[model samples]
Target: MKLTELADLYRRMLLIRRAEERLQKLFADGQVPGFLHLSIGQEAVPVGVSSALSDRDTVSSNHRGHGHTLAKGVDLTGFFAEILGKATGLCKGRGGSMHVADLSKGMLGANGIVGAGLPITTGSALAHKMQRQGHVAAVYFGDGALAEGVLHECLNIAKLWSLPILFVCENNGWSEFSPTDRQLATNLEKLGKAFAMKYRSVDGNVIADVAAAAGKLVGPMRRYPAPAILECRTTRVRGHYEGDRQDYRDAGEIAALEARDPIRLAAEALAEAGAAPDLIAGIAAEVDAEIEAAAEAALAAPLPKSADILADVYTPAEV
Candidate 1:
């Protein structure tokens, strides 16, 4: 990867890492409302895939989607505010974290339901193809969604019509509280082949590797307009939700995953690529300051008014 690109990736990955860390603290202190599903150790998937997409390209995200939304260019303040349920949030505090959406940024909102993004992404891809727009739609989901019926149906239809969509499965080994292997026996690559779609898998902790793999698939997806799947083997450092005690995970699992932190790996790659140590430190410092400022602003923002609960829910037709 180019130095500039590597720096950009590192910056984004660090932003995600720091932001989630802050959110964890905030949630612990009773600041954020509702359940929080963090993509703490899965930053590389969104950073890499989004880097390969254009501003016009669209993406759909699942419950653990703060990273995806941020990587797609949602403003930091709005994202934090949304999570904090402030009126100044992306959905005016109505959607909170799971439903955060900014259509202007081509983020089609994060779904709360498993496997929900598949059809939404497929529809967006169909729209792009029908409109002759040289854009693609990428969807982020977990390995658990592989069992959802919608996933296979969407894949079959996407292949039949050659939709310009990328199915990104962030397989973190665990589905909710259970290991994925215990719930499903199918190989993702072989499943992709069943539908005759392009498929690839990579180490989700390595940003450069993920980016390289995403670029190769997403590049041709726009020109030829076909469905593809990129299975990223990742790790989730936190519990399923913020407060759940992780008795299901083996004793050393979390520590072992932390040892391969994506942010640290990216920094090492940057240094190896001739990036100065000061430059790397500066990046982390900048991201930290940014997250802190956003968090402060979000905490101080006003709550949504009770009267406006139904304001943006529907639109009236022109008279």
Candidate 2:
């Protein structure tokens, strides 16, 4: 990647970090309405993967998907408003933190259920295949979703049909409060082979590694289309959700997580890759100001009115 591209990735990674950090404070102050699952330490996976995608391509994001949504070109102003439950939000405040989406940007939606995106993206990829649209579908899920039946089902279908889809596993190794390794019988590498799909695992903290892996798999789908799995070995620093004390984790282990922070790693990478210190510092300042202003606007935005509560409902209220 060129210096400009690398810098932009740095900016985006910083944006996700700052945005989530702001939400952390908001949720703590009782300003946010719903339970928040933050992807604080997993910015590189989304930033690197989303960079390899086009606007017309679709993304089906999992529950912990703020980074996914933002990296996929969702505006910060509307994103903050959506999480703040404002009427002007992308989903008109209906989706909130967990279900936030902007279909205009080809973000299918951020699902609340684990592994829900798997089938959604699979069907989307099938549509692209049948229609010959030459667009690839990307689904973002955590290692926790490995146990879900839908993961296998989707992979089988995708393989059978040669669907143009990318199964992105952000393996933080945790399923809510428990470790996923203890819960799952098989891992992603074996699962990839079981499904007869191409697979690559990379250090998820390094943005270049993720960008390269995703670029190879997702970008080529338009022509030499096929199903592939990219496992990002990332980390999750926060609790499963906001407000949990994480007493389950030892102090020493929790302290170690700070060292693995993606934001810091990305900055270091950029500097090592010949980016000047001023450029990197400027990017941070720019992202920080942007997040602060957007958060203020989202907070000041109007909440959903009680009278218009069911405006965008698909199913009948009687049901």
Note the Cα lDDT for every prediction shown. Answer: 0.93, 0.91
Model 2 collision count: 0
- Each candidate's number of clashing pairs is 0, 0
Best by lDDT: 1
TM-score of each: 0.98, 0.97
Per-residue lDDT tens digits for candidate 2, residues 1-319, read 7889989998999999999999999998999998899999899999999998888889999889999999999989999999989998998888899998888888999999999999999998988888887888999999999999999999999999899999999999789999887898889999999988999999898898999999988877888679999999999999999987888777787788788888898888888889999999899899999999999999999988999876767765684
Candidate 1, position 47, lDDT: 96
Off by over 4 Å in 1: none
Which candidate ranks first by TM-score, i.e. highest?
1
lDDT of 1 by residue, 181-227 (tens): 98887968889989998999999999999999999999988789998
